[model samples]
Target: MVFPRPRPPERSDPASCGTHRACRSCWRDPGALPQGHGRIRRYAAGADLAAQGEPPADILTLIEGWLLLSALLSDGRRQILHIVVPGDVVVPLLVGSAGFGIQAATDATVCAMPVAAATTSPTAHPAGLHVLMKAMSRNAAMAYEHLTAVGRRTARERVALLLVELYYRCRRAAIPDHAVQIPLTQGVLADALGLTAVHVNRTLKTLRADGLVAYEGGMLRILDPDRLAAAACFDVEAAGAWLGPCPPGPPTPVPPTAPMPPGASR
Candidate 1:
């Protein structure tokens, strides 16, 4: 089925959310103060919302479906940095970021406005500012989390943590029957986690065997949320915090690793 541009949600519509009541999501009560209204744009799945080197001068806020925020390396490698859903403010040229692009992971609609107008609108609503602030904070934390996962986590741990993250992110969208929708392919997972598709596949298999999580038919089921979090060392609160993750604590050996042998041959 094709997704169409959403109608402006009136006060009675569920989509018409209050500033704080919207739970940090962006689009709601279109044309209302704080959530400036704009022209609606629709994108098909796999369509580039923002091309690798060309970013639109206007801001595009999601009205529905998922988006893949990515960056392309000079060597032609792509890194899937974030997967965003409805009520998220997204633009290709994120502040201080170059080489980043956004693609539609599923059919989507967005409310678009020019940068200058969006910033200087008479209805400079706090909700709009909240959306911008929270999105930046959360996205930055996510990038840092991904960096840690890629650098220090095992393949299985990385996959588990990623799944756990998605589980929580989709909770707001509803996890019907313990399952969350995941439209991404293993290749996307591989790019996100800095692993090969084979590695992601094998790690997912291990997660299934461990009864932590399992994926099938575009859904990921968390069979054991507690156990899965333990395996991933996931800090759920930090992951979902609206004010952004807490300042990280100093590290210590948990399972404890031995230091490199003294005077070992280089």
Candidate 2:
């Protein structure tokens, strides 16, 4: 598909321009491209950014809005793997047949860099390579965490943990607020959490009644972040370690490697 000509990068804080902290850090490097290198494309909600089973071509970074990485069952059921927010890089890693696909969850913009360029551009700069490697590592860590949540967490815990995770991820993006804008419907949440929409609705209601969170008009207010975290049993230290410098602790046990899923490797 033909994309529009790229737009100029936002003039404000470079890191603040997108969602991925690693992408932002790389942008801040002295050797970073002055105008940035990539084609920025706008996608309508529900558009396919990358299709499963298609040959990989470019690495995409969300510049605005949300995307969903998902897989389709033979019976046509959709299993959402993860949500992609701004600055999240979408890389293609699986060969032969794609295991997942990327769909825009909302009207969005993404920067598309040719895989060849994305790989070779950072070779001359140690800082750029470091940032890129960290980003990839963090992405893998998060994928493992998602797998764990899907495989083991209870319905309530899964929903709560997702909220907590999003809250902190937004905070890491420098969005300073107690409220988070969740551009997902209950159905989407259900798909991501491996629960039915009714179950998700019930869980959310319970959270609201407990005064742990408030969801209204597409915004989620964390009324009691501490209580919410407690409910989800969120590991704050481990989760936030990938974001920035923190006191060292025992390393987070690496989740066993599995076949590459669409969003898991890039």
- TM-scores of all candidate predictions against the true structure: 0.72, 0.76
Candidate 1 weakest lDDT stretch, 10 residues: 253-262
Cα lDDT tens digits for candidate 1, 1-266? 11222232222222322333333345343443344345566677777666555534656667677788787777678888877866566643535434667778788776665654545567666556555566567667777888999899998888878776665555555423332456667788888899988777777767767776544333455676557767988777756574233222225211111121222121
Each model's Cα RMSD: 11.4, 9.8
lDDT of 1: 0.60
- The 0-to-1 C-alpha lDDT of every candidate, in the order given, reads 0.60, 0.64
List, residue by residue over 151-225, the lDDT tens digit for candidate 2. Answer: 999888898888777756654543332223657777788788889877777787788789986544344556765
**Candidate 2 residue 218 C-alpha distance from true site, Å:** 6.6
Q: Model 2's lDDT to the true fold?
A: 0.64
Residue ranges of candidate 2 with Cα displaced over 4 Å: 1-26, 30-36, 94-97, 121-126, 177-179, 216-219, 243-266
Can you give the lDDT of residue 14 in candidate 1?
23
Note the residue pairs that clash in candidate 1. Answer: 26-87, 34-125
